[model samples]
Target: MSSQAEHPKTSSSPVQNSIPASSCPQKRTFSACDLNCKTIENKIRKKIKHSWKRILKVCKEKDISNVGEIPVSDFLDIAGKFNLDLSEGESNQITAKYDSKKNGTFAYYDFLQSCVLFLKPKETSLMKRVIIQKPQKPLSPGPQTTSFFSATLRIQPKILHCWRPMERTFKSHDETRSGLLNVSDFKQVLHDYNIDLAEEDLFNILEYYDKNLTSKISYYDFLQAFIQ
Candidate 1:
């Protein structure tokens, strides 16, 4: 009986060894997967860093109160900056989801989250190498363009939180009633808004809107470059 029992146990050794050999590949696969995960995580972190820089730059340029936080009212500005064609309701929902503090502002990390909210790990790799587009020449106002920018206040009041204020601000600076602002006037208004930018940066902002290089910007110009 003892000899028979020993013989049966001996036969199981080869099978047990084969099981461990098969598991070696499974372990290697998990190891490779872990490396891939780390690579993607690193890419995400890099994108976050770049986004943070952009957020700060925009906040400084716009003179937003909280340096690292973005107000819900500025969602349009963010959307425009990032080329996100989000609707008013979509902007509101995104803000509500990430703005956990409910302080009318999204924290820095929250802003980053908003920027990449819809992207998965694979998608982030594409985002990491995205190139900034050059500002396009301002198209002449047509019916379609007019409808696109037509005072969205009544239709989507929440999204255009800064619309009225921008109107008032623009009017106050547009002393000639030309519905336009020259470089000096533009600089002064930005100053009034507390945007303390260097001379070169200010010129660059003006150039972006002054596509004709006319050294002046119209109300529509301002709306297109900053408000839309």
Candidate 2:
């Protein structure tokens, strides 16, 4: 049996930082530039380390906060809780990562959150190394075309519990103006990872609960399964 009282699991894929197009230009890129892709690369690596450590703390304690998205204050709170004395502006890179949440490396944050909320300890090895398509097709000319990254992390079945709701409430107007994710979508995600849970598993979970139980699955239900 697992050592912890809870069986929740989480895993996240790795990511390579993107060079801000405005930041890295051919004519302006000399030897020293703060926003240089190389500089950003180093900053990204450090940020990943810092972010991973903060996230790891929560996973170890089995605390599910931010609904999966780890915020800046939460990062600091976790660091403080563990007595991890990081310097001021220490999380600047991470903050930058989140700031770029809309455009830059946003996929990383999304992918990482899935990892944190759904993976188990035994599955971590699956993400240790992965191949990412380098953005060789440069948008501009310069020394900025040689870097792009990706990695995979597997979530063990032992650490996860997910559910699905019967009906999906969508905004119907825009992708941005969205509603809960349906079970089928969540199942498709699992299918991509080749993680299979028999229909019996779903039925068994719902057999007991009267309110939380549902005849179908929704993104919200899937999330509910984890926190419960």
Candidate 3:
């Protein structure tokens, strides 16, 4: 009777023993491959910014009309020229992603504008919307133009696959060792390679490649266009 009632044994709640949800570590959403890709992209971006002035100069040189558009091949060349060291796959991905017009050319100025936010995060005001005007329609293709178009479509795939041998062939044909070939030499080289393009087709091809109508073909540039 003198003994005090035993205090009820207090049971600890399960919640009291568990760690708080906010204090628990979060599950990672990115895999190793994702992290690696992100690292590579960051490196590329930094290189691009570091070579900004040089890149702009090259772009200006290519974009003679100040139209802010350049062929995809030239873009890739500029990347290589400046030692950006983009892989073929990386270059392809970039062109596919940024070629908004899907016209085999990219609005490089617009592209730079888009990259400004990533390149210079502090310059948010530079992220203005660019109204890309539709490129002017090329004049109607004559018979030679048509033949050239067909020939290019057929030969480009082969050139991509056998670039080294094709390059050697082109260099072998260059008697001047100047990395250029006149129309006749180019046609002869194509014939030697069994490409079988017509004379008009060859002329049209040269016309397309010779942006300045220089009456000479930079075979290296032509091959680069196809290989890329």
Candidate 4:
């Protein structure tokens, strides 16, 4: 992992139901929002990393019913300790956006998102510039080798688990429904879904699927690259 204290590199995602579109920065302000997203995400990650153990302890002390999750009240208390200005309205919004289980509590990553909601931006319109095209070439199944078999066995289940969600997630973010995600859109999708990945990681993975160097990746190639 990179130094938590250093600059972060995640992208932005869609506005959740609780946050109105008007609350998101308009397209005119996207460039600045883009830069802020990286810096803010980095800071949030660093703070969370430093205070995670403490947060967990707080959860236990508060007697949260679900381990690794904390209610809004406890979250606000800990957020205050971290010097975050969490308001009741914002806390409710965060819970609505990230409490995936509808449990009125937040998992660690989701909590991180809530803490940095100001950094989340509207989906950048830049992705619209890249035209969606079919995959120029199919991914190779790989050479038949003993190591391949072992690796496949080890990773197959994990891939299956992520595949369906990955597809669904990609579609959700691809508002154009164009069966592809440009680089910006893909990064934003990763950010929206709270996938822990670096900018370099996204680029390298995209390289495998972006055969034409078009900066666009199709659904088939997305599945291939995402699973890796």
Candidate 5:
């Protein structure tokens, strides 16, 4: 990957839910006797219900669970009500994941929810724009023999043994250097794992070796570096 082309990339779904809407209080369990706060809470509750209905309708079509699927349209409606905006994507090639088609909807909803709860609208509209430049004639990354992306990455809490046995914690592109292992880690974690990764991806994988550094990434944001 060219150093000049490498740019910091991130998944912005989860962080959007950490912040409470401007109309919502910090605490979710306040007594009703506190009428002032209760009024604000009530509004948030009602809004969630109304927004969820419109969002969930689309997810039902995909026959997937509700853990992550929520339409972006519904999320934007709620965020706008609170004068907030939650944005994601890299101006091109927007990416995200879920268990099934339904999950994709929920993931979108989750992203918007997190943003509304935590972030404020930007001074200049926190927007994601697209300027589709002309192709300038078709261009090939390089010779067809070698794929433009030479690296693959997989991240998970632990390895599963349902398909086979487990030995290590994490695996990467280097293992696929050989063509002999067809039924290897190549299929399960990389191809269908829902990582429609960029061709020239860049990011660092930081192993949690030190107990003291319990978690490096914060609730506000996350970072992933994949060099491909």
Candidate 6:
């Protein structure tokens, strides 16, 4: 049998052993496109912060539990309530951006934080000092020692002359025709009618009228109390 001559196994060539520069993964560099995207994102955030209070109020009205989230439909309704004027596509984009859980609900607190810079407790020492210097009285009345009707008597004369017009104004603000107005709207009606009362007294009236803590007072029932 003829023995064939065996050659030593050749080692991998440099071209084969070394990875090509093109084939190796490269570190991503921040480009102008990325900068433009960041600019647009910041603009959206600024706009959101500008309307933060109204958005929060509407969200609170709908999310009574204060879970910091609401159904997508309610979230959209909030836009209409505050006249955000979001187009269908814009609304969809917002929902997608804030619905982090993918559960069909928008997390409002997440959205709020993305735009609004809330002061931390440690950062609000100045505000705390101001509050401490002049403590605010609770808006809700404590112990029902006095009758509500008696309380109304104080503001009666002021509202008495313009009572009918005041009723009309209150009804007009009842945009939902629910015959009820939220606390802010009720206060606004009183302001428009030029019926002023001390803050404590105004809150006392609200507490009496909003006994259920529903944040809504029936205008008809409320106005009748003033007359009586």
Using lDDT, give the best candidate's number: 6
Candidate-wise lDDT, in order: 0.41, 0.33, 0.51, 0.46, 0.26, 0.53
Compose the digit string of candidate 3's lDDT tens values, residues 1-228.
111111112243111121111111124233543344345456576575556556766887897765556888999988888787888866765655445456666556544433322211121222123111111332222222322333454565456566667667777666556666666666666676677764545545654555455455666555543421
List, residue by residue over 1-228, the lDDT tens digit for candidate 5.
111112234563111122111221234223322344333334454454345444334443442543334453544454555532323331011112211242223244333233222122222222223111212222211111101111111222111111112111112222432211122232323344343434223122111111122222111111111100
Q: How far in Å is the alpha carbon of 103 misplaced in model 1? A: 43
Candidate 6 residue 210 C-alpha distance from true site, Å: 0.7
Worst 10 residues of 2 by lDDT: 143-152
Off by over 4 Å in 1: 1-163
Candidate achieving higher TM-score, 1 or 4:
1
Model 3 worst lDDT run, 10 consecutive residues: 16-25
TM-score of 3: 0.35
lDDT of 2 by residue, 1-228 (tens): 111121112243212233233222235443443344334444444344436544454633442421223445655566566554555554444334443343332223332333333312122332233221112221121111101111112232222322221212211211332222234443445554455544433322222211233222223323322321
Residue range 26-134, candidate 4, lDDT tens digits: 3526455434544444555557545655664575577544344567566677778876454564554444444546656655433432332212222234323433333
Candidate 6, RMSD to the unseen true structure: 30.2
Put down candidate 1 lDDT per residue, 110-144, tens digits, no spaces: 34432322212122343234322212343332221
Q: Per-candidate TM vs. native?
A: 0.31, 0.25, 0.35, 0.29, 0.19, 0.35
Q: Which model is ahead, 2 or 5, in terms of lDDT?
A: 2
Per-model root-mean-square deviation over C-alphas: 28.5, 17.2, 31.0, 16.9, 19.1, 30.2
Model 5: residues with Cα > 4 Å off, grouped in runs: 1-5, 8-21, 25-192, 197-228
Which parts of model 3 are misplaced by more than 4 Å? 1-149
Error of 3 at 220 (Å): 0.9
